[model samples]
Target: MVKGKATLALELPLPEEGTANTKQERAYQAIREAILNGLLQAEDRLPSTRALAQRWGVARGTLESVYERLQLEGYILRQVGSGSRVSAVMPDSYLKAVIDFGVTSTPIGEVPTSNPTESVRSETVHRAQVGMPFVARLANPQLMSPAEWAAHLQRAMARMTPDQMCNAEPQGALALRQQIARYLRNHRGIACQAEHLLITNGIRHAIDLVARVVLQPGDHVVVEDPGYPAVHRIFAEAGASLVYAPIDEQGLDLSSVPEAVHCRLAYVTPAHQSPLGVIMSATRRLELLDWAQRQGGWIIEDDYDSEFNYHRAPLPALKAIDSVQRVVYCGSFNQALFSNLRLGYLMAPPQLHNQILALWHTVGRSVGVSEQLGLAAYMHGPAFLRHLRRARQEYLTLRDIVLDTLQKHAAGRYRISGEHAGFHLILWLTADQDQDLLIEAAAEVGIRLQPLRGYCQQNQLEPAFVLGFAALTRAQAKTASLKLAYLLQA
Candidate 1:
């Protein structure tokens, strides 16, 4: 057997006076330079915390802190039993190459190009293409079993009649509408019949139908400040003037709504406030319903992702408490099941049923009969509940992993909110930190984040970012959290 070469201790130079402000900074710079200059190869083991502390004449705690910073920055990897090793891929390699063309090191899995400009452009594009964490409505596709869905589709197809194939209902298939009514009654606590529901392509389509039917040119519409941009666009395109309402800890602040403003429609994500994630308080919910009833206005309750409530039993939907029939309850299977399916439904008020159906007939194409039938069949069977249970458990695990890692690694660096429900949560940063810079830094290391300001209109909310946890795996949650914590604390 060949003898293995004995590993040698890393010999880093001590900090000189006036060179670095502190020993920690100096030591950090030195080790970072070693890795960047190829003096320390990837996967090379480093001395233990105690050994390094004694070797460098620093406290063990200081050495541990240094290692943690290095690990957080992706320059090193630390395992409890296996000790610390240089990361297989270095972030500095990419940063250095982007800053100056002096470094020729390529990131792992990237192809090297001879043209410097092309390489930089390609790298910039690649960074832009990184998976962003705050993307809303994203779910782990792996959690959904495609084979089972396909089987349901096959069954629906086999049972399809010629009349059903040739003729499609404008209000969607009866079976699907009936199933959706039952689901809403049971899960959302909304008592409504199949006639109250209209099968829509998604929330956007549902909003569009409501807009065309209800909104007049120059009609005043009340929307949440940090609300869904698509809703704003839809109403705007319909020639409606949008009045912004601020969101508070209790959800959309009804007090902020100008009492003088006679709004025709108020669009809200009451179950899970978009971007901020605070559920509309019970008092606020009643207040909103009263506002609509008194003002003769309508409320579009977009219950986007209420299925994955982790901490407490979910509150009844806003539509559940609408006694005056002023609320239109909208929901989608796309977020819960799959995005590509494009299946959503809305429970319209009885008065607008005919008008909505008429407008839908004019503007919308029926959702595929097979898809509607298959989904109806799926919802009726046991597999759908099993899928929900599995997905909820997986999402809950991911949420915990993210929350725990962030709290442990980056304590006091940030504040968290809207974590009790939904696929994403708000990570409010300190007032002094630049949200954009942190976002840019995160993207450089292939961790994408969205600024909370992007979703707001007029309200000057705190500097924060929305962090989605639904699709992250165990390893991804830890790594991304560490990187994010480093960016915030750095």
Candidate 2:
């Protein structure tokens, strides 16, 4: 009955202005916009008939008519004790659709999701519609334009011949590995060959494979303090000690790299640093490679969004710059194609390839061989690069919309970073700000964004969040920005 107890959400997704003919419909749109815009969110008890009527400067009956309209649209549910509570969002079928498109033919539950770090959000909720928006990986897995890739996908399916179905190559389809290698060499400037590439069931498998190969229990690993925490969790489960280092404006500050570096593995998003969005300078990249090579350490390069740079083409991947062969390069089709695709790869030097592949065989358990063939076909056929071109444009447009909206809406309370590439961005709250409390406040009104606090290391730095823009339409981004701004203003 009171806003005191409930989850915060964005103001509801509203119908557009002037789209509905009746006053009730118009009022419904208004209230819906408020909810979608985060002006009104879940469990925030609505004003009574008289209060709503007075606030809108409308007759009581007219307000009644509007509330009734919202109820009919399933925007709110009324109960005896709880006068009117915002309705949970209607689940979109994109997640299910992607699942059906043949990634993990054996349902996810059957496989146990390989990685233990998958939370309620990763498993149960596929598309992040309105709750605690995570910025590291995109929430909307179906973010790729299927219609655009329809031709490429068709080529892939055709390539999935019965011969491909009969056998499972532990190293993945040879053709696919070759395709990936060519793509990397041509696009990222990384020198890879089919011999070094191992395909697995997405990033989880790739990360797990890396963990199994490089890290021993209790081994120390250097992790960026404000980098993706989900990753740190994986390394921990693998029994590694995560040594935290703060990320600065110029990418992660390695100024403090210990002379006696103890970690066996170090993870960095050097191309466009996660959360911070700054590109690592070529000089720093050389130093980092040198440090790892000298220490006999392995660098886990999560080239998450190296393919989606905005201001310029992405920097050469660390793997490309390395003569030392210390970089274990990993990436996925999750960002470019879809999340549930479960298609990611790890490429290591020939020296470490067997161990990495053995880890892949041990942990991956099963691979989506058919999808790999399809992806290989897509990559080689005329459609792959073409699809990427269109995707880049759409993704960039959405990013611009996000920037414009944040600039227009979150004027005083927020500062955005890491905007040049990737699916998400980071917003650093003012020094005096309380992100935890502010996140709760945001929920009360209906806008859900991840607070940066969860991503930080023990008692370090100010709070910030990683947020994705690829999943939202430009219009929705604008509305979300406005909603977020309202919360900040409050």
- Using TM-score as the measure, the top candidate is 1
TM-score, prediction 2:
0.69
> TM-score for every candidate vs. truth?
0.73, 0.69
Q: For candidate 1, what is the lDDT?
A: 0.75
lDDT (Cα, 0-100) at 247 in candidate 1? 93
Give, for candidate 2, the lowest lDDT window spanning 10 residues. 104-113
Q: lDDT of each model, Cα atoms only?
A: 0.75, 0.66
Under the 3 Å rule for N, CA and C atoms, how many clashes does model 1 have?
0
Clashes of each: 0, 15
The candidate scoring highest on lDDT is 1
